[model samples]
Target: MMRNLLTLLFPVLCLAQGTNYNFKEAELKARELVFTQPDSALVIIKKTLANSAGAHDTIKGNTYHLYGLYYNMKGMTDSAIYYYKKSLPYIDNYPKIILRPYINISASYRNKGEYETSLKYLNDALTVTKKDNNKTGEAMLYGEMASNYNYMRQYEKSVDLLLKAIAILKTEKKTKQLYAIKQKLANTYLGMENFNFAIDLYKECLPGFKEIGAEKNYYLTYINIGEAYIRLNNLQEAKKALKIAVDGLKKFDDKELIGITYSKIGNIENLERNRESALKNYKKSLDLLLEVKSLWTLRIAGEYIDILNQMGRYSEAQAIINKTAPFQKNTKLNMVDRVVYEKAIAETYSKTNDSKAISAYKNTITLMDSISSAEKEDAVKEIQAKFQTDLQREKNVVLAAKNNALTKAMKAEKKLLYLYIIMSISFIVLILLYLRSYLFKNKLQQEQIKAVESEKALLQQQHLHELELNNAQKEIIEEKERELTSTTLQMANYQDSITQILEKCDLGEITKVSELKKELQHLIKQKDYWRQFETRFNSIHPEFNQKLGNKFSKLTKNDLEFCSLLKLNLSNKEIASLLQISHESAITKKYRIKKKMQITDDDEFEKILSEI
Candidate 1:
């Protein structure tokens, strides 16, 4: 009877095992497709979820997690977070499986720019790592936390966390993860403007990325290295790195990174005065940026417009500016990009309307001030000091352990010495006291050295901070000088127009002379614009007149004025219009100034005035 029952149930057992095997296989296939073919992954995940009813909790949880990954790849972050949270409860009992949902949820919050909330989720994941003693999970959590700190502009904290992650990953022989953390550390250094160090670290990561066959990361490192070189003003090296990145990135469908690479190339071209080539690269960048509706579109649009304006294609510049207007309101727009966009607008309007140009320049300055205020240099220095102190404390802890072991050995030796020679007890006691004193003094000296090193590091950081501040202040002053020049030019144009109108009236015998006179008086009484311009110019560029006069004492007041306009890079036509002179007269005036300054080459003439 028992043998007949076993035979009856044999087919049922095999069918159940087969069903479980198929479910597991489907889950693995979906996981592999989540990033490259999210639609297919979604289809697989839906079927898995439907058929996962009454299955093991691990299977159900994995299916839900795969669903979340599908949403994540689709850029539906909120949906991703929801599904990740749903998976958490199902996988709560399984520490290893639960980590995925926690980490995914944290990434979703990070994408939303809720960095604090992201850290909270990471902390939850950290708890899971501790519970399972999962070193890999701990390292991953540290990397994620470092990323959040980097975004928050806490570079010191970011560096410390990334170092911790790298240490663990190195010990675990996690070559892929070790390289990934190193790349992130390089990025943090890049943000801090430590360009050479960043370049070194980026170079170090490249081989590791290649060894792990992370093709995308390998090329991306080239892009970062390019950026660091660009910041360091090594345009030739920058171009070489970017070219390598461009060639490699073409094999992938990541349009945004490719767009960024093209934009960097555009910058290099623009710097070299290859405006046409720059425009071509910028156009490629803009097209891809627009196709992806990337946030970088506004930034590249600003650059494109600046190039168009430089080429005297005002209509094209204005068209691009108008097209990018809606994106200006996006809160996600980087403040640096906002400044660039506003400066572009201001430059565009300076050609036609002074009032609008002034407004836009003011906006640019305001944005710059906001950026300057947000730097928090002192806080960063304090963080650096604290990090150094923590490192010293860790070293001291190791030293103390060594010292305790030595003291135990010495005590044992002392007992042996006492047993061997009771008569030499006094001599041994004196030697032991002397040795203890020497050890204490050595420890003190080591601590003093550590303190000096910490202080030196803080001083170096402070010096870098001061240099940044000086550069920022110089930038603000240069912008002010530009504003003053525009105001002066506008005043010249206004006075010229008034004089022309009065002359015409005198020639034609206008009927409303009294009304016209009253209007003219009202306009003339609206503050002395030229006086304001001079005062501002002197305040911003305090030694401009003195320096130029000292170099060229033969220059007249009018010659100096022309030189100032030239310093601002005004075109001959614009200068002629501002001075209410004929184009030929403007050219003659420039030649006269050049002769007075003893300059023969046109470029040399402009260079002298610019330096002043």
Candidate 2:
């Protein structure tokens, strides 16, 4: 394995030795490939520095970049940053490399958690990256900005930059980097409490990791998916996914990941109320941490200790606290990170009934309070300046939140006002529709009343004419003269009145007085009237079509309006109503027509209807 690794390094070494190229780009790439690669990077950075004192400004700026990498690897980050700054003045010509150098310096500062200074360096890098048109470098700069924002807890800004990085990665088609960006996005989503989106991003990363054989990332994706599901309280899915991951990952794998997986498994089992299984998993995680002797893993140890105490396994939990308590003893922990860690420890100690541990916990809390008070007095101006910016940002957030609420309220009010206007218009439309319908019905009723009255007058006149003819009987000339004198003049007057009524009447509306039996029989006698009657009557039976076709086959004029429309299977009421006839009379006339046409009353109307 050592030989193979060195063999890989041989190609990289040859790449470093190529001196014809004035730029030290290949060396930078080789160093970036392995972040922990200080020793191998030393030769190139040394040569670049040697060239710095010469009259070449471009070589000087490049030397600064190489120097930063060498110091960074040695863990002498401050000294490395100082040298890098010292060399930047000599390299005035190489603006492209100058941009990347600032990024390197900023990354070094970021590792030290000097975020404000880091940001200043990042801005320099950004300006340089833009000047050079280095899209990949700009994307890296964006990723760094996103990382910085996340550390500052400016999650929204972080997410925005991360999205920008993803866009750049997509354009570059950097599949592996895109996968890394996806993980960052997923973490940001987790911070924003958007778990569904977080889970989706994590799922997307799996295929990318598989493509690159990135074992760690593939495992992480599985773990993240399980964790996300666990937070959603989808215990069955969480447990199933996590168990598969736990079984698949080897025990001698990445210790932090293995420990985390154990903790997750323990947590899931605990949620299921499987105490024994939970205890076993927790112990497995504890054993791994102890074996690694990793101070970083001690934070996790603190969490497990708390759970163990709750499980009535006080001795075992206490043993862990005793073993890992030394992690905080020698380390230089940042104030905030220290407080959070101590808080985890204190809660565990308080639960375990460990009096000494509890005293230490309380003392630390008191010490933190005292330090905070002193911080206000001693570091007030600097701290206040930092917090002032944070304060202003918070003020802006509050105002923005208020403005959002106001905007939403305004929109709602506008919607309600529009709704009221629409409702008013709708009410007016409905009222108009009702009024129009009522008017149409009233006009039709008036026309029908006039038609009925005309028919009644016609009937009474016919009856009077008949009575006069019957009463003056059997006297030949004398009786005939009397009949003529009494009835002829009256009959002539009645005929004139009937003609005037017919002339005044709407013949279009009053088609037949099928309203009464006498009215119907009277209509059947007139030649012009039967023509109209046949037009209306032949509409009923199927055989009516056969008779009409035979009779009118040679005739030129046609009226489909009355005949064709009525040929459909209509009931007596429908036919009478349509033809301006009474229902009962229409039925009688239909029977008479049926006898004339030779049609059964119900001979499956539609089957015979096809002939028509």
Candidate 3:
């Protein structure tokens, strides 16, 4: 899951110095790199901080804040908390500035599963922001607290906090943040299964996403809208929305998301009783998901198998079951899907008059019984939750009444205090006038100190960035080498296994014809094994296909596969066996591939493929 809506925060740099140290410029550069090149950003921040030993507290604090964001990005929650806390004392005087660290620390704690501790820090930040009347910070803190509540499974509290956040954003006319919060609120309602509310909020947020040109988010919102419509039994609208989502998702090249979009469209078609269309979409979804090895395939497989069984495509359904059996074996498949698969297995066995039909039926019954019990237990928990939510709301109402009374009383007290302040204003002004020169001198000294620190920071930024970039690049290269070594071993093992099969067939050590036929059929079904290898290769060298395509657009898919095998350093015989071809044929194909790329004798094809 994406990190719960912790809006990416960068430190605010307001340096006014014209000196060469340029702390603000260093900060600006780091902020730009932090999201895309975090290690380099950290280098800049550390160098700026080290050179700023005698600088203004604010500069040091901003560096610490950047450090927090860097660690958070890396998912080092404890380190993030440490850095955020280190910046607190320096920035606490600026409520808007100080609240950021508090909220960040809360997010770190929430991510660590310490929800109560996260809430404590969030409440502290909330108080500070409210005292400062900083609406933006208040809304941000509210949003963070809402995420924490959502983590705690306190959905009611999460919704309430989100509403409070939305209210603040709307009142402040913060259109960007307002719509973002609205989206979150809609998702919260989705979690609560309040489809109408979710759809309403999603519709409200859609225009803002478009206005911001957030195509991905807009597509995602359409997805949510489609899901809501599906739940409402509005299949026509669901199809329209999901089709748009799929079209939009294709632009981003996120295979898993594209698969999910297809799966959802399959659901829409299934609901419309368009069996053939549903099967086609589901098969397409399963293919893409299998390519990515997405966990979602388990859920879709259950539906796909059920549909195949209904259509009397028993062999295809059994093939899918066997293909996904490994995932079902090791992973906690959802109970509903597991039962669906079990029932389909029972039906398949019944058609064959197999004894396993009885066992499959029993398994399905037992699994369904367990699901029923779980649902009952969940129902009881829901009741308990409702009771607690009601009590909490009552308490909130009482607290609001008390706050209203306190506001009235404070207003009266403020009026009296103002009268007294007015009477003493002339004397206070005369005292301030006498001390003005002293304060002016101190301000000048502070500016001089800041200028010196800024100059030092400016000098260190570039050198540190270069040093960090080289180190980061070295680490990346070593990591890739290790990955390549592992993949090469797996491919070698697969090739050896294929060679073993061929040798076994050749020797015919008392093998019957029926056994040989079964073995060949099993081998044919084991194409998924090679597909797994291809998936892993793609992950390690994501740019491989794209690079090959760009260079040799006419390269056949088989040729591209040949290039991947070559990159793994497979020998001609091994590649031939894996690709189900003769050694001479593999060599001819390699020549053709090389010729298409115009590679001469001096060119190292393997080395060139490996680089991609």
lDDT of each: 0.77, 0.60, 0.74
Give the winner by TM-score. Answer: 1
Provide the lDDT at 304 for model 2. 70
| Candidate 3 RMSD to the correct structure | 41.1
Task: Give lDDT: candidate 1, residue 308.
Answer: 86
lDDT of 3 by residue, 529-585 (tens): 556667767776788988888887889887887888787677888777667678999
- Candidate 2 residues lying further than 4 Å off, grouped into runs, are 1-128, 167-176, 240-253, 287-296, 329-354, 357-612
Off by over 4 Å in 3: 1-8, 11-158, 167-173, 191-193, 329-612
Model 1 ranges off by over 4 Å: 1-21, 26-54, 63-86, 108-112, 171-173, 244-252, 291-293, 376-612
Q: lDDT: which candidate is best?
A: 1
**RMSD after CA superposition, every candidate:** 38.5, 31.6, 41.1
Expressed as tens digits, the lDDT of each residue in 1-612 for candidate 2 is 000011112111122233455444644553443233445556666665554343345555555555664554444557768876875675545655455556656765665567788899888878877887877667767877776776656788998998898899789876566776677678777766788888999889888766654444466678878888989989888887787677655522445457678888888888888878887887788777666554435556655765765676767766776777776663433444454455555555545443444454554455456456644445534544544454444455545656678779989999999999999999999999999999999999999999999999999999998877766442443544344333333433444444544654455444555434454456445445324334434433336555665754532223332344335445666555545557887767655544544666556333444355
lDDT of 1 by residue, 128-240 (tens): 78989989778878888887888778899999999999889888887666777878898899989999999999999888766644566678889999999999999999999
Backbone clashes in candidate 2 total 3
Arranged by TM-score, best first: 1, 3, 2
